[model samples]
Target: MGLEPDNMSGSSPEDIVNAVFGHFDPKNPLTFKDEQFNSDPILSEKALCLVYILGADTIQFTDDRLIEKLQTVRQRISEKEIPQVIVMTKVDEACSLVRNDLRKIYSSKKIKDKMQECSDLVGVPLSYIYPVKNYHEEIDTKNDIDVLVLRALTHIVKIANDKLLRSDFNKEQPLTYKDQHYSCDPELSDQSFCLVYVIDANIVQYTDDRLIDKLKILCQRKGKTDP
Candidate 1:
């Protein structure tokens, strides 16, 4: 969603944040077509993840009003438990080494610091921050630039997938293992059958020891070893 300029009639930071979270009112003058999802229940419910694209060179120069809007957006994302990642574009412009050699992105301390700065400002973890060089002045595709962009895209897709998995788990019936169906409800007696996911470093970690033990027992009953 795009926000109006600061001097525009309806360009409040709160309105911009609301637009990002699918909470903006359709009748608002600043509202755009994409921001009108809040009017449709199905469209509003379909937003599974949020990607905040930020300019690497411009973040440090961002105005206080824009930063306030970003913080508001962060709050909404946290409140909804929506997975988010910051795409730090224009890395080449931010760091001289990256500009001279795109392959040096991972090894460049300057790029790393810029990524950390983005994470700090956006309230996202460093692991979720991706630094990429935008195709600004290039006529031909470069391998280094392609690699960086593809890597960032891959992470974005993975995060979206995880969010979808979590949403599916919430909406679907409990899974069945060993011919026994279990309820995913936390308050139910069969809650032990449910698996809880701890997302870290882009990996999904199952933290339910009881569920693991139960699976082991089930395997042993079938005369099979745990894989």
Candidate 2:
């Protein structure tokens, strides 16, 4: 689901909010539904992740109003624990080194700092943010451009896939660790155990030895100790 460029840059807050929440066109009765806007995982079909695309060159040019809009969306999405990623597009325009050669993106400290800035602004971790150059002026598709774009997309897909797999396991059986009742469903338990290690390590903030021991015990009780 792509948003119009104006929705992020020039639109009023109210309009931006409406666009994020999604609006129904009266003329198109068949397409008029709130599902497009709804972020609820249970209500919506496969709400795996939310990707926020920000132009590399526009970050400094963005006004407070736009930042407020982004914050509002970030807060709402965070509440749901939905994985968020910032696609920092147009790195070529932002850094001269990258503009000369896309392969220099990772080695360029300037690009790294720009990515960090985006991460800090969006309140997402640096690992989740991806920097990529858009093929704006290229007459022919370049391998370097493709590689950068593909790398960003690959990360996004992997994160989304992990979320979907976890969600599916959750649906089969909820893994509630509070009351000593780990999921009785063996498949669910196994998947949850795998997820505990597979999901972004940053997501699991509490990783003390005691907590690890408890989880290991829980897995053992479920007959799968390997995590």
Candidate 3:
């Protein structure tokens, strides 16, 4: 599922990547659900504020504010169990904010003037963010909007397929490590495991070679490891 819409800017990277179909509706602007946007335990009010700035009726999605939003998005992504793809649209306009050189947007003289404030807001490297625009062209009977959408979808699939995950432990009994939980069905179906780590919960991570042995010892002492 996606996080939020970027209003004038378009969908976020995470939204773009996660969406199976449909991009943000330019007509209907809205923010992310408070429950999901506030998912990260370490996320501060500033993070929410950055998102608010990006998707608000005002703020114009400046590079500085955009960078801060991207950083918060990255932090939110890291906290999630899945990798995310962010797509910031209407970037054709942001190009005007750059200096004449334009070798890199952030390196441009205008953007450089606000570097300190931008960095303070967004704790992410500039290299990771990508800016793009989708303008409907009438000059060509067969325009490339569909192609761009297809390309975006293909890229999202690639990212989803390339996500880094914990090594499969299919053969072994699922263990309690980090926030991973394990429970058996009385009907004897396959076990279920939910590992929503990187967020706060009353979960445990006691499972190194030594720690596993120690836990086994204690479980056995209390008769919690039989069967």
Tens-place lDDT digits, model 1, residues 71-189: 77788778767888899999988889878888888899988888888888879898898888888778999888888889989989888777766754543455565424354444756
Off by over 4 Å in 3: 1-76, 96-127, 136-153, 164-227
C-alpha lDDT of all candidate models, in order: 0.72, 0.69, 0.40
**Which regions in candidate 2 have their CA more than 4 angstroms from the true location?**
1-46, 168-227
Q: Write the per-residue lDDT of candidate 2 for residues 1-227, one digit (tens) a residue.
A: 33333554453434334333334332332222445543332423434677889888778766665576677777876665668899999898889988887788899888888887788777889999888878767799989888878998999999988876665455445557663556555675456434444645785886678978977877677775554
Our model 2 lands, by Cα RMSD against the true structure, at 6.5
**Per-residue error (Å), model 1, residue 84:** 0.9
What is the C-alpha lDDT profile of model 3 across 46-84, one tens digit per residue? Answer: 111121122111224445545544665657645533444
Greater-lDDT candidate between 2 and 3: 2
Angstrom error of the Cα, residue 84, model 3: value is 2.9
